[model samples]
Target: MSVNTSNELRLIWVYPDLLSTYGDQGNVIMLARRAQLRGIAAEVVPVRSDEPVPTGGDVYLLGGGEDRPQVLAARRLRADGGLARAAEAGAVLFGVCAGYQLLGEEFAGEEGQPVAGLGLLDIRSERGEQRAVGEVAAQLDPDIAGEMVEGGAPAVRSLTGFENHQGLTRRGPGVRPLARTLTGIGNGDGTDGAYHDHFIGTYLHGPVLARNPALADHLLTLVVGHSLPPVASWADRLHQERLNAVLAGKTRPVCKVQADAEPTGTRRHRHHAPGTCTTSPR
Candidate 1:
């Protein structure tokens, strides 16, 4: 689980061909750029369905895809066993939307039939009648936020993104959510994402990392194996500008769902949940 001897950080972009819906490949680009800007040599390796997943990667990224592709990706991942093995060896993973759903125990397939997942996370996703799609903003779990940024200058509190999904995830016992929903329907359960061990799964798209540079750096820190000194760059400026625009009330096209149809535990405003990094019993 150490960086390659050549001093290059190996990042595996999992199944990009099958899971690049919503411009998720941008996440891999963002991760590499952030590492490069900080003087860390990084190499991105795209793992497609036809290839074996690389176990030497420091970080693995899986993006959203259509239901059929998701089911296929799930089956391929289960058979390859590379992601599971890499995670066992302490590699970090970031799964988004359909990718996020596939990390759990199971998710509804294209026909609403249950499909087996990689089971890297202790959660299950079911297809819901209402799809959650819109501009999403969530308050980061305080403890996770505290650990993400260097110098503790008020860790990035809010995560902004666009969500478009129909899977409603129910967290298993002891699972901690990544954030609390501030604007859109997240997980259809008030929570926005799931975080356990070194794995993070979310429905946020906006190619999430680009809009949340601190998060990108946080993941990079894991790969580089140390606290990285913060650098103010064009990426930071762009992130702030986008955030400011979001806060200023500029919004994107969002799917409409009846208010009464909202999930029971979700709230219209932010709610602080206790943050814990404990993983499911192995």
Candidate 2:
């Protein structure tokens, strides 16, 4: 049945057992939180390899995983056919790293063997000779930037996160890129991700949405068919801090928070402006 109301939304986390790694499941958690903040009921469903994926969901997410597991996930999802059914009925799909690769027609797998994918997005991945691993910073593609930005928050235009993958994806005619790289190997051609209609794919991993709520809200907006409230000051600040850190060449340690550190709302990086950054003592 078509949704006539946006009062409630279902967020599906596909294949958590075989396709979730690098804290990527956090993306689903953040999505749920964003919806609650907007007073929209959100149900997060974590489907494992052993279960049948529920086809009735507003948004579905697939996260990064190891090669062997990725191959398995692709095989299982293809066989289950739930994801394709959901997408055909207008559900939004988001994939990251390994999940990103498997959304396309095919991807290079263990030992560079070929693995067929779901073909939801007209893209393909071939394992690069050298892995791209580090903090990556990118400016959103203008079209995506305009849709994702809230109230003209410039920081939302810049995306920052950690990427550790070997797949060099190439987009086909059906998909437009999600961002242009400013500091790392993205798509191996300066782009970081691909999106077409309601489907999006990317490689960034700080669970992505945690570091960039604008992107999170953008996904939510698509499902809700409207804009979201302004991001919390702290969320915008975190986005700015991460963007600046990598652009200034700060490594992972600079973005680290202590185990007992103050709440994210209370802490601020010394250099909060773009292009310049410093880690505030925790």
Candidate 3:
């Protein structure tokens, strides 16, 4: 993936029909709006599971999904071959929750069996006995800070979002932890996400990009190959609010062991897992 020399940015949102359990699609919107705000022409391409994924996107995004759907998505993505090719060619890719799990070598299936994944990141996920649900925040790894401009917005030290997952992820030598866990069960080992090369995977999903604009900008910078001019302060205030709340122990709950009944709207995604409430931090 060459540095975006042109003014337009091509972004691909993969498997929306199958992998959009959370409002994680907002991640795509966040990237696009942020780029467009900076005077870059941003084009978002949505690829359904049945459709062919284009391999020419500068960046790609994958969101959360359920057990069966995730299994199907992994299988179909392998057959599609476009995403793997794009990654192999150095496209920047970001995935959250089930999408993150599927980017690894394997993740637990609905029956507790291991299922093959897209193998984009050197990580693995296994189903834990208990579901993890709550607000989460983390201090971004210094490595992430190292990539930022010398005087850019103080280098985004911490990140905040919501998380709901049953899989405990372990990072392999090929990747590094995206951040150190500050609150909530991310990766179940005090690490929040995994990153290697241009691929990033995470469990946090208040549409994680929405809560952490610096990260969104990081991806944009990778594609654009330069430090972008700062846009606004509103996202910084929002980030600080969540970070301060989590640091002060405001662990807002997004799911319980059992929800009495599903809400009428999109919150229905919360009812997918059995025996306990599970969702994409919608």
TM-score of each prediction? 0.85, 0.85, 0.86
Q: Write the residue-wise lDDT of candidate 1 on 43-109 in tens digits.
A: 9999889899988898899999999999999999999999999999899999999999999999999
Question: What are the Cα lDDT values of the candidates?
Answer: 0.79, 0.78, 0.80
Q: What tens-digit string does per-residue lDDT give for candidate 3 at 32-149? A: 9999998899999999999998888899899999999999999999999999988887899999999999999999998989999999899888887788787887777678757854
- Pick by TM-score: which candidate is best? 3
How far residue 16's Cα lies from its native spot in candidate 1, in Å, is 1.1
lDDT for each residue of candidate 2 in 1-282, tens digit (9 for 90 to 100)? 323244578899998898878898789989999889878889898898889988888999999999999999999999999889898988899999998889998898788898999999988888877777778787777788887664333336778878999878878888887877666766766567889889999988637988888888888888877777764646677778878877676553233222232222111212112332344333
RMSD of 1: 7.8
